[model samples]
Every structure is written in C-alpha cells, then in structure tokens.
Target: MKNQSLACAEFSESQIHALIHLLSDPDHHIAQTIHDQLVSIGHPALPLLGLAERNQENPILLDRLSSVIADIRFTDVEHAFQALTTSSTEEVNLEAGAFLIARTAYPDLEVQSYQRQIEDIANILKQRCEPGLAPRQAIQTINQHMFVELGFKGNIQDYYNPNNSFLHQVLDHRIGIPISLSVLYLLIAQRLNVPVVGVGMPGHFMVRLKAEPVFIDCFNQGVVLSEKDCAKFLDKYGVDFDSHYLDPVSNNQILARMIRNLVAIYQKRDESNLAEQFTRLLNIVEPRE
Candidate 1:
C-alpha cells in the first residue's frame, strides 16, 4: 500500500492530465488499466477526471469517467456507514443513516438542506398544536398538518420507485412507501415531543404512540388503526400475525428496512448494480452473520 501510494504521488499534475486522455484509448485493456491507475491515485485524480468529463466529446469516455466517480463516492459512503456501525453510541441516527444511503445515488445531496426541511415541518406542527392538548388531539393535529394540509401521501401508483426510499425525495415530493414515510413521520413527531414510535409490521410500516391505543399509518394519511385492525391488515396481506411485529423498531432496524426496500425495488427493475450496492450496505448496517 505504501509503495502504491508513493507511485500515485509521483505522478505530476501534467501526467494526471495526460492519463485522463488515455481513458479514450482504443485498446480495451489499456483503457481499463488507465481507469484502474486513475482510481488508485484516488482523490487527487478527481479534478482532472472532472475536467476531462466536462470537455471530452466522446460519449464512451464520459460514461467511464462517471463510473469511476460513482465508485469513489460509494467508497466514501461505505466508510461513513462503517463508522456508524462501529461507533460506541447506543442508538444510530436514523436521519443521518437515511441521507447517507440516499447519497449513494445522489452524490451531490445537500444534507443540511433536508435537515432544515424536517425542522421546518416540526416547527409548523409545534405552532399548530395547542398547549396541553390531549395526545390523541395532538396526533390528529399532526395528521391534518402533514397529510391533509401538506399533501403527503402514499405513492400507490409508483410504490416501487426507489425514490420512495429517500427522505429528501419523500419530503420534496410528499409521496413515499410505508417505511420512508413512517421515518419522516417519526422524525417530525418525535421532534414535537409526541410519543410516536415506528411499528415495522409485516409487509407494512406505521407509527404508534407509546402505550397508546392507536396506530398512525402515515402511508394512509395517518389513518388510526387499533391493534385488532393492525392484525386484520396483516392477515389481509396473507402475512401471519405476529404480536412482535407491532413492536417499535430500533433506529438501526429502520435503516436496515429502508435499505432492504431499495434492494427489492432495484432487483425488480433488474438494476443489479443498484441492488448490489444496497445489499452490501444492508450487510454493513445490519450485519446478521
């Protein structure tokens, strides 16, 4: 590794510039070798590669450079997730985990922008709720604000789109599948000091107040469901009812589910590359073996 680093360091800026051109080499083997060498040079090669990508007229070379850039960004995400998994902290930051996963596909995502968006939602909810309101009433107020007024809803038409797994997209578009919308609801509800927690039911996701009688189905416009209703919904879906399924999932579990959802979505679309990326991330974030 030391020798490889030294070799990479020996290449001057001019040499890196010239190597960028080699990406367009006619010989496949030579072009592949150049790609590998550029990647091995790591971050130092990014600027030169970016310049080449901008100026290069060849569509083939542009695609190759894009792949290399994606690989580098994936490495950064992998390391970030590794730190999250190996940290001494008791609870993972679910919001941060979601954004990190999103960044695998959206490398230029501005995390703080999304954070502010969530905070803004929470602030609106705070303003809407009256002081000393009943928990049930408070929940209703949140439902009205989030679902009716803000127009957030389940994307039934395109439920399988991978965008539904990303929090930013969920917020921006106001549509998502169960788990992502549940995470969004949980984040905002928790911020308002509501007792809501995510309930990762079989084949569905929802939220419920701790020790409360009702479940909030964010995907269904915060429809309130009883325990029996939850069981019936599970049975309707042909999923065997498990009492444990109604238990609140940990932040790590939530993150794992989000990634698993993306993996399934990509797999159905035959996007093997994306499926593989999320699958590897799932292993890191929720290692079972």
Candidate 2:
C-alpha cells in the first residue's frame, strides 16, 4: 500500500470487491489508492464510495475520512438527496445548516430566506443583552427573556431511554431536557463570546463555560459553577476530571447534541415511527462513525 497513483481500468472486479475490506486496514494508503482511481476515472462513484469510506473504520484517519472531500470531488446532491428521511436531529440539523449556509451563499438555491431566520435569532440575542453581562448571566437573561418573558416552553424531556448513545447520547432518554437547553445555550452563547465547551459525561450531555470570572453550567439554566462543584458532579457520575468527560462543544456540535437527545427520548417512548427521524438524522450529522 505504498503511495502510488491508481486508475479506473486498473481497478478490476477484485479491487472493487475489496473496497470495504481495504477500508478496514490500519494503513490508509489503500483507501487513498481508491480515491486516486476514482479521480483518474472521473466515474460517478460518489456518495456511495464516499460514504462507505467515511463510515467504515480505518486507522490513522486519512484526508478522505471526511464525506466533504467526496462532496467536493463529485458534487452529487441527487444521490445524497434520495437518502434523506424525515428525521433531522441537531447534528444533522447542523450538517444541514452547513449545507444550507453554503448553498444559500448563491442566488440559485434560494435559501436566502434562512439567512433572515439566522439574522433574526442573532439580532434578538444581540439587541436584547444587558451591558456587561457575563456569559452565565447572559445565558440566564436570554433564557428568562425568551422563556418566561417571551413564553418559550421549549422541548421538555419528561421520558428517558438507554439506547442510541452515540457521540452525544442521541439515544439516551433521561437527559434530553437539559440537552436541548444546552444546545440553545451553546448556539446563543457563541455570539456572546462565552467560550462554552461540551461535557460528554456518561448518561448526560452538559456544557461548561471557560470564560473568565466564573465557570458555569448552561444545562442547569446557566448555573454559575466552581471547580469544586464540578469535581463533586464528576464524583457523583463516577467520572474523574478526565479531559474527555468535560469538553465544550461548537455551534454545530451543540445542535447535534439536541437532536441526539430527542432521538433517544422518542426511541424509548416506543415510537418506532418517530425514532426514524433521529436515525436518519444520525446518518446526515455523523455519517456513521
């Protein structure tokens, strides 16, 4: 599997058969070879070949680990479109958001309307902030201003489940309430410059503020936190203060967390029909692995 060029005619039935098998190899050179072959042939092997390579396990994640490279190489939206389902979870939503944000940059896609929505959300948050509010204070003010003052019931997770615990517990049922709020918090806080991080703690998805003057928990309605309290929380959850346990998330990641929360909640409710929304969502957001 040395780094060498590949061609389409060079790819025989044997090579095609080994597509999945080669992807599992520790050395990713085989996968790169496949990519070279596709690019050489300029064949319409996108979406399928791209997704297979992405989802299938491979060591030392190569540049091709992303579905984006395939997206750029092939630009086949039709095949990708056919795979879509009704489920649009938060990560899927974020992925969709990325796609939309990109597509809307053009005059052809006619997604300009969404820009207004984004602007509206941003505008409301920006115009309605109290001067000199800390990140925690800002989140609380935003929540209260939107929830109680503006009557935003938001999504509540009264029920809980155990399966579908992918990156953000997309299948867990009990933690969806705070999960959704955390998603909103991350999205809104970024504009406020709060520097929120994600805590992928067992059985729960939470957020921590890294901004100065105070550490805070957005999941608990922007509760101001201390390192001591965080340590206690970790002890209660049986997770030490390991780096992975209390990581912050990005805007898209936050959105993905919310969708995952809903997926778990609905799946546990025995709503197979409803669960599909999240299942399809996972494919779009995380794209398998």
Candidate 3:
C-alpha cells in the first residue's frame, strides 16, 4: 500500500490479483493491508474483486471482496448524491432523487425499467381521464385505478420493512408506507398534468392539489381529508398541529425525510453501521434545516 496515491494503471493485473488472494492471509494486519491496497486502487479493482468473489470457495475471502466492492460503490453514490443536492436548479426531479436513494441498497437497479412501469400506469389512467375534470373526480379516478384496480395498499402488517421506503421496491410490490405511497401518487399526478403536491405532516405524509385545501391520504386508499380533519387527527395523536405541516415540501426535503426514515429503521434493527451510513446521507441532503 506504499504507493497509495499512484494511478490504478501503474498496478499490473497479476499484482492486483496477488493482493486480492493475500486477503486470505492468516495475519489480520497482513489481510487488512491487502484490503486497503485494493480499496486505494479504487474502481479499477472492482472487476477483479467481482471475479474473485464468484470463483473463490472461501467464505471469508468472498466477504472481503464484497466489502471492497461495496465501499467503492458507496463512494460513487456519495459523490452522485452530493452533486444532486448541490445543483442550482429550483425544480429537482423527485423520481430521480428517490431512485438515487434506492441505488444505495441496489447498486445494479435498472432505473429506466421502473420509470416505464410508472409511465404505463399513468397511460392507462390517462385513457380514463378527460380534459378539465373536477378535483374530487380526478382524485376518485386515481384512487380507483391505483388502489382498487392496481391493488396498491398500505403495508400496515410490516410497516417497518425497509422495502416500504424504497421507490423501486414499492412499485414492484404495490405496498408501502405513507411517504413512499405519497411519492408514487405525486409522480403519477405529475405525469397526468395534475397539480398535486406533497404534504409533510409530522406523523404522516399525504398529497393534495396546488389550489385546493383537501388532503389525499395515499396509504389509506387515497382517502380525502379537510384541513380541519387533519388538525383533529393530529390532536388525536397528541401532536400539536401547525399550519406549516400542511404546506408543500420541496423534493429535497422529501428525500431528506426518506433518509431519516431509513436511519430510524436501521437504528431500530440495531444495525449501527448502516444507521450511521444513512445518517451521513441525511447530512448531505438535509443540511442544517
């Protein structure tokens, strides 16, 4: 690991393989040194590490290879998230941000495939909808098509399953928590030219129209609610309701909330390392706000 800063091209193929095989060394210090060397080589070591993981019979060596690949991939994800959070544009694509978070868990996810799934759903619903439909009628159409026809519903039995928070998984399974469901609804609404926005309530997430005061609860069969009803629901939960909680949250704020949800889930499962990883991601997106 002496020439840690050297370009990956300087290291020959056999030299890198020698380092990878040395990962099975009995000495912990020696093995760690080899791991660090491979990591320092960065993305260039990925292909060899993947090959070693598949061909190697030793479980320990396989685990080490997997760790190295994850480290390198996570570094790339961090840089991508940083760039997304720091962009100058006011309108960030919510779907893009959600998929980026999903990539943390699924490094090889085909994003376009999932995008097409959502697009197909929108297209089917678009055929049913006519121009200049009423707000309530539009909400009813979406609810019927999404929940009743498509079989999307809340995962109340296993609410904390991490899949409930990931967009791709939610789309695949059609079951998710409030925030993820709201995100799916918002995205579909955007496609149909509906003026919907996310309402980041303290205990629950919902969606509503830009000019209307009614809230649509995507998790519960797209149930409609008035501002007074939302306030009373908050009171029932012993939470003091504030007007700002009903205000539309930006896409970045929604992504921050998603990260925070992951951190809480990992903490609950006693996965301290994963919790810390998501906490760092939260810092990158949420900032001090």
lDDT of 2: 0.48
Q: What's model 1's overall lDDT?
A: 0.87
Off by over 4 Å in 3: 1-6, 26-33
Overall lDDT per candidate, in order of appearance: 0.87, 0.48, 0.87
What tens digits encode model 2's per-residue C-alpha lDDT throughout 62-90?
34534324333322332243233233442
How far in Å is the alpha carbon of 235 misplaced in model 1? Answer: 1.4
**Which stretches in model 2 have alpha-carbon errors above 4 Å?**
1-140, 143-157, 161-176, 191-194, 210-215, 251-256
TM-score, cand. 3: 0.91
Question: Cα RMSD (Å) between model 2 and the true structure?
Answer: 13.1
Off by over 4 Å in 1: 1-10, 25-33, 130-132
What's the count of clashing pairs in each model shown?
0, 14, 0
Error of 2 at 199 (Å): 3.5
User: Candidate 3's error at 225, in angstroms?
Assistant: 0.7
Worst 10 residues of 2 by lDDT: 165-174
TM-score of candidate 1 to 2 decimals: 0.91
Task: Kindly indicate the candidate among 2 and 3 with the higher TM-score.
Answer: 3
lDDT digits (tens) for residues 180-208 of candidate 1: 99999888988888888888887898999
